[model samples]
Target: MSETTTAESAERRVRRRQSRRELIVLAAVEVFREMGLEKATLEAVGERVGLSKASLYYYVRSKEELLGHVVVHVVRAQEEALARVLDAGGPEERLRAFCHSHVRIICTDPVGRVSAQVALSGIRDDVVRRPLHEYMSRLESILRDGVAAGVFRDMDLRIAQHSIIATLNAVPLWFSPEGRLSLDEVAAQVSGLLVDGMLAKR
Candidate 1:
């Protein structure tokens, strides 16, 4: 086959692989959320996805791999949110956009939130842990950049990142569409506090 055809074929194969992976991950998310990490059974996920337990093993090597996939998916979503912030206008705008995007993802995707909490402890593989830690590091980098730019107040980036993420991560626990505050409203409140705390003192 020609080089162009080969490249196209490769791209198609990648898409197919990604699609199958997504399906498995989605099913795993439901299973994990319902059962929690320690109790989640591969057989349950197989049933959810309409596959026999043995058949599901073809896609996922073990329950641990499924846990990894779910956590990795959440990490990827946060990374995408950070990329969106990079395209935003100024420090304030970027911070607000990041908060909004982050909160929306966490609250709306409960399964993702649960996966983020449970997967780290449950996975014994460095292959999974390293990437998750790196993705988390990106959040601190954003805060540090804002501080250096004089838009955000000088504070320990580690504490700030942890405090902010911990608060936002809890959104999945109590957030409700019918509740008093909308997602955007909660995000704005969080952004206000973070920005105000980080603003240069007059």
Candidate 2:
């Protein structure tokens, strides 16, 4: 085969593999969300996708491995979203933008919320913990930068970071699309509160 043909074939193969992986992940998400992480089983997940237990094992070795896949997806998505906000004009804008996106994801991405909750206890190794730490550390750094730039008040950076993430993570508990407040409206309100509260006083 020609080089161009080989390249095209490789691209197609990768796309096919990604599609299959997404199917499995989606099934896992639905099962895990309905059953909760502690109760999520490979058999149930496989049944959700109409795959046999053995078949599911081919894709994922264990519950922890499946959790890792889900966590990676959530971490990467949030990272990409936050990266955009980091590039915004100023510290205030960046922080507000990050809050807006964070809230949006919490409301819409069930797996993302589960990933955060499960990461606390689901994974037991330093290898998994390190990436999770880095992801959160980035968010804390953003808050610290805002404070240093006189956009946010001089407060305990770790406390501020915890408050921000805690607020965002709570959305899955009370958020309802059919509720009075829309996601955008909720995000705006949350962002406003955080920004106004953190603004440096003249």
Candidate 3:
């Protein structure tokens, strides 16, 4: 085969492999959510995906690594969404969008729900901490911008940031697609509660 054709074939193979890996990760998320992280095993995840335990090892080295992959995938999506909001809007708009996006993320995806439900202790410290810190930093920057713009009241940045995140992170624990509130309703409620609380009283 010509070199170009060979490269195209190799790319197709790589894409197929990545697609398989993503399926494995999705199955792992379901297993992790159904069985708590402590109780979740590679064998259980493999069974969910119809792979033997040994075959599953081809995709992920260990349960911890799988957890890291799941967390990273979820966080990376949030980061990308946050970046778009950050780039286009003023502080107050950005803050509202951020809150709304977060709620949507947690409520809309099984993997995202798994992220909130599962403990991150299984993942390497830096792997878990770095994305969290970066996301929090983005949040703090928006808060600070609002304060500077006199749109938000002066307050402890750390407390405000943590409070907003803590509240949003708790959504997966209680939110239900079958519940009375829809995803957009919950997002609006959450954004209003947190964002309105920060607004400077007229």
Candidate 4:
């Protein structure tokens, strides 16, 4: 009984620690996004989460580390969102879902906004760069599948993928949640244009 209780206590501690780390990461994302990474400070992030500078250190080692965590988190989210569409949708449907995913990532998610805003191509860490590479590959896989299925055009898949991503990434530059056009409206419009352009001729 004591062993079981001890194990449960340890598990709770781990869960709490993980929960706190995630909260701090979220706070860090907001700080970095608002202030831009080079200008963002640990003190600001800690204040957002109600933690002191010293206490924030317990959760994250540095601003760079927080950015890394945000990168990994953002990419993982993008992959998982696409994975769900890839699993059960047809080419057209999957492409539409991808549009929604793209919009949500850039416009709705704070971490994702930061990821898109930052010059991630400058990041050299393999751990950070690895997921981004996989993300690009997944995007190409979607394009390739669409082409093979006779849904997408026969043009260079790389160009198509890059164009789609570049257009979507530009959303946050001018997108406003408080604007007249809602997020869904933007996604639908983009998805229609991109997907319809790729449709196989009747």
Model 2 lDDT vs. the true structure? 0.78
Which candidate comes out best when scored by lDDT? 3
How many residue pairs collide in each prediction? 1, 0, 0, 0
Q: Model 2 compared with the native: what TM-score?
A: 0.79
In candidate 3, position 15 carries an lDDT of 95
RMSD of each: 3.1, 3.1, 3.0, 3.3
Two-way lDDT contest, 3 vs 4, winner:
3
Backbone clash tally (model 2): 0
Mark the regions of model 2 whose C-alpha exceeds 4 Å error after superposition.
Answer: 1-15, 83-85, 116-131
TM-score of each: 0.80, 0.79, 0.80, 0.76
Q: Model 4: residues >4 Å from true position, as ranges?
A: 50-55, 75-88, 119-127, 177-180, 200-202
Runs off by more than 4 Å, candidate 1: 1-14, 79-85, 119-128
Name the lDDT value of residue 64 in candidate 2: 73
Worst 10 residues of 3 by lDDT: 116-125
**Residues 1-202, candidate 1, lDDT per residue (tens digit)?**
9999999999999898788879988978877778877888999988998989778887888877776777688778877777856675877677677777777776778656765565335456765566566755776777777888887888888888767766766666677789898878987887788667777786
For model 1, give the 10-residue run with minimal summed lDDT: 114-123
lDDT of each: 0.75, 0.78, 0.82, 0.79
Which one wins by lDDT: 1 or 4?
4
